[model samples]
Target: MAILPRSQRLALAAQASARPVSVPAPITGWNARDALDEMPATDAVLLDNWYPDYSGCAVRNGFVLYSTGVDSSPVRTLAEYNAGATRRFLAAAGGKFYDISIAGAAGAPLASGFASDAWQTVPFLSRLYFCNGIDTVQVFNGSSFASASFTGASSLAFIGCIQYQNRLFFWLPNATGFYYAPLNSISGALAFFDLAAFAPHGGNLTAAVTFSHDGGNGVVDFVAFILSSGDCLIYSGNDPSNVNAWSLVGIYRISPPVSPRAVCQYGAEAFITTYDDHIPLQQQLVALKLGQLPPRSKVSTAVQNAVRANLTGFGWQALYYPRGRRLIFNIPNADGTFSQHVQNTALQTQPWCRFTNMNAYCWGLFRDNLYFGAAGGVVYQADSGNLDNIGPVAADARQAWNTFTDPMRKRITAVRPMIQAVSGETVSFGLGFDYGDINIALSPTTAGAGSPWDISPWDTSPWSPDAIVDPRWRVGGGTGQSIGVRMTASANAPTVWLRTDFRFEQGAAL
Candidate 1:
């Protein structure tokens, strides 16, 4: 008689596949097929959207001011007024900007000569700059609200504005160029300088952001511009006026059909969401760090199919919160809700999570807090409480690990799941043998107090080891060449799939 191995260990690693159609065979090392409706990190809770229907958001003086969406009958806007004795919140609606400082406070037209109610506001240089992409830029200083005047040009309209290197840069949609005001100057009398002539490539300038870092010579200033044609241009220099001094450092190409507002800078890296032209409607979330080739990894593939099915044109938004080390993309769904794909860059273990039930239109990071505005003049802070949406919503985290197969045919007797979970948390397991020919449900396992944090006596708490739960069923005398397991958790508890141990009887080759 020859002795045979009694058990085998199968590790769950890299659960990147989320689409059921793309689920890989368990024999491969690919860990999961889906992790939606849950957080990206291992054993973390899924948080819901905080507020209701706010369409726009901006952070000022430690408060998140939200504005109503344009879909409503009368558009509403929110702006902070801190000029002189007027320290209040202003509301703009019904084709007019009003001073809604106090409840019942008589509404008055915005003194800034804002002719239209549609405006996107951003705070920079001690003032709030407002633009509707068509009208002249409006600024609300601490003292007064007024329209900005540019030298040589009677009226200046820009799609977006960003403050970098003490200078105000605006994206010129009409001329496919970029114009900037003097360094640290926000006065209406300053002349706007054009950088289009100096730019290397010719294309519609969709977005621009500055990146500063200490280099060989000293602090090097670089501005990255994204073109409508999916080309990225980088210019290096400290001064924008000295056109000759600013040299083109690098250029990279990305998939076109991307949103102009979906680009964000994280450290020295820029993350953008775009669709692959080669693949029909295949969306990808890519990252490009300064001085490096574009990364080939599509971090958003976990929900790529779902996003492509629901995303509308190039209207999505991307935001990065440094404190949480999170990169969030808000993609509009056809159902009027929004699908927020959150990536935890902080934890390299598990980096993707898809969140739903929230319809955030805009996001703002204020004082290390993440704030978002939804559709109906509502705003909420993220990571504030455990509850998701508005009520106690249960988490729906699920994963299907790779299949386990023996070199020769075998009879699977039982499976022992080694899971680390919070006390009282239950994890359900589904077993499929012989490439899913025979499917069976294993007895659910409830984890014990597996960590010191789960028990009392905080300082003196002992670390409890993990408990391996063995299924009682013998697979109904199931015989197969391979086996796979799928696990799911709906409770708001932390869970981590360490590995699964399989006990089987060896048999002759088929």
Candidate 2:
């Protein structure tokens, strides 16, 4: 076989490591990674359009904005033809116009005057559910329409809302009253959270009510709300327990067009986005310091062993990890202060995945990846690993070293030495070196192969060349003081150091 040179070999190895590992897209596993490659840019959907339906409108930005019309006409039965009506707005967003049904199937055209907003897919149910007007709730079973009618909602007027806990929750404008219609049981279960007393004249609550993890803190749990005034309110989720009195830790009031809807945490920073603001101008997504938690340490070594983990804050409302992705966080604008340079690259990807160019939006997270609702009811997902913890590894020449062969002379690639441990004892150890390995001799005298020593089963004498040996094994208990030997290398290989700990179990008595 023709062998590649060391230089060429190393370069090939590095390049191979750089390419992202691809996984199949949800459902089809169709490797849609390149689906949007040749997609016509003219067909792409913009951020300004409204999508009303369950899994209603998907956007490339990793969010699906479903609208639940506040009110609906009871008498109109949408025939098959009208059920899938295609409408072209005065402003064209270039994508092919397709009927928005429950799932490209049978459903009455949306009840007249019914508007949809931020309706998310329900787990285990194929239907997309949302609140329409004040008194009515609607559902699309991927094929047909089902509705939950309300008696008092016909006249209840509200502005700006979100879906939570399998119910449509919204705040009435000017009245500041919170109402919810359960999609599962809408008739009698239709209830409204009496927020009228809390914010009379209706303190504009922009989005949905959400909770946070207290991590066992008993005093108070936090709930979040966005005011129509564009201010954020963080209050206690206390129900008169008095353990924690509802108080505002931070008040955020951004300018108009800067309507804040979602707030999430990333490490110690909180990122928030507005309803319709795009990239920079809308200040759509902003990062803020988490008042409850401390900043995460950069040093990986220190981070693993530190006593204080520094995790804090309440949970999120609108955005959540449905599938694939592990950790998702949002940052508020820095100190409620705006910066012109910072852009919310929240869901930017090269070779964007285009599904009919309608709209791409993220619904949930599973297995550390994001579950997205792309155009055509086709779903797409991306692993969160690629987005988080991205940076070049800092290189250092002086940190390199070797061991075993010649600490001061020979440069070693890798090395391992023998180790002998006694049973019933706990062993604590550490490795300190520059780069190369240091060999350590476990037992000085040992019976050669084929004798009782060989039959002992516990003996690893014959397999001495393997990882069984520690290059630098320092004896313990006597003059050695229970400390293992030191393995020093002339060069370091960005290695495994920084005070490691592990339990070593001995097989048999020496």
Candidate 3:
């Protein structure tokens, strides 16, 4: 082969140039990695109020009027008691519990004078039992809210409780064992079961999570007692008081929970929110034995660096909303503010997302619907409509950098965020260069003046059906080796993101 001159080769390479490439929008959800610039193109660098979907990122549903003005203090907990066809929703705040079933100002305090704000509640035998580590175990029997009549445990102030094997079990703070009542008996003398002997790490029991496991031979229900030292004692039995009926499964040490409320049960599997990660208790055992990462570490691996400071923060809790198929983990800050790390479990990958402007202190379910207790004396029904209460939802997303493995710098010239909007919506377009957050201020969004550029022409498309795709090309300008497109919108009408086209020059030495 004949050798080409250096100038000729350079000229040929320059002439070939690089073409514009379009990439599907990120749907694998928010990735708060240490090196966000290195994340996959399908993962979001910063995503809020938008859920990851297989087709694209979709706007989240909003909250509506539930109840408010319970007290000046924060509404710490929301609970429900369902008996047959009737369901009653209750709100707790300022050391008092109120009946807030209807949408209005909370009714008078149903139960008052409690010391702690946190309460562990479980519904059993047509009534609900509560434990707060400071107050006597309170029982809400649909009408009355008062202390239980357990004869033997009158002096015990239980911190947490769960219904396992047909018994109401209670545990105290800084104690290795727990208290349980006889089977099928809600009001009776309680029996003490000591776990100090079986637990290996010898730490106090923090919480009990009840779930079922299927190991090829049908499903088996188990209650997992989580120790503060990360030791978990799982038991399978109906009667703990009977030596022959009760038995210990195994004691495995994993990441301890941030709080007693950090464990969330979705269907049959329970997810434990620990200092380092959110993983299933069953998978944690297998991962520990096989020396592999828990399959669901994706929940925390993406936000490990971001959540490291919040592992010990207050108001850390997880709740599963079956109506919306969302698994929400509440992360509170030192300033009394909070954000939610939510996952859409309906999706196969169970993609993650972050939610803002919805500062929920705790979550509860009533009539198979989701509701959350808020900071300023209120309870809002979440996943109800297109707007977050009254204000619009601020949907923001930052796509991973699109470098295409090129070492040379590039300049992004334009971006087209295919959005399906009702009527016409405005979306701000900003471009972040290099590897960090974008610095360019987005220009005002203007609707397309000309005919639509999609498959169907203007008149033929469904007129004002729900929403239609707007193919307006946004003019963007930035210079860097990597370019990440940031799309932001605050609208009452929810929208969908289809894909993005990054039109740019490949080699710009300047």
Best by lDDT: 3
Q: Which tens-of-lDDT digit does each residue in 1-510 have in candidate 3? A: 999999999757644563567777778778764366567887887788878865577778799978878887888888899988768998889999888888898878998999977898999999998888999989999888978888776466898989887788998889999899888888888988899998888899987899898899999999999998989998999888787989998888877788999888988889878877777777788787787865544447643543576656657888998877888888886566778888888887677888888888898888888988887797889887889988888888887777867767886666777776665566666777787677538564533333443454333433345466665666767678877878787767756676777666676555
- Candidate 3: clashing pairs of residues: none
Return the TM-score for each candidate structure.
0.65, 0.33, 0.89
RMSD of each: 9.9, 20.4, 5.1
The ten-residue window of minimal lDDT in model 2 covers 88-97
lDDT of 1: 0.50
- Residue-wise lDDT of candidate 1 within 180-286, one digit each (tens)? 77667775444455545544555677666666556577877677776766666777764666768667776666654355566676766566666531111111212
- Give candidate 3 regions above 4 Å deviation: 1-18, 299-313, 405-409, 440-466, 508-510
Candidate 2 lDDT over residue span 154-256, tens digit each: 3443444444434455555444445555554434444555443444233655554444333375433344555555544445433222337335444444322
- Which sequence of candidate numbers ranks them by TM-score, best first? 3, 1, 2
Candidate 3 local distance difference test against the native: 0.79
Ranking under lDDT, best-scoring first?
3, 1, 2
**Candidate 2: regions farther than 4 A off:** 1-128, 132-136, 140-144, 154-168, 172-175, 180-185, 189-203, 213-221, 233-271, 274-510
Q: What 10-residue stretch in candidate 3 is worst by lDDT?
A: 444-453
Candidates in order have lDDT scores of: 0.50, 0.28, 0.79
Q: Candidate 1 vs candidate 3: which has greater TM-score?
A: 3
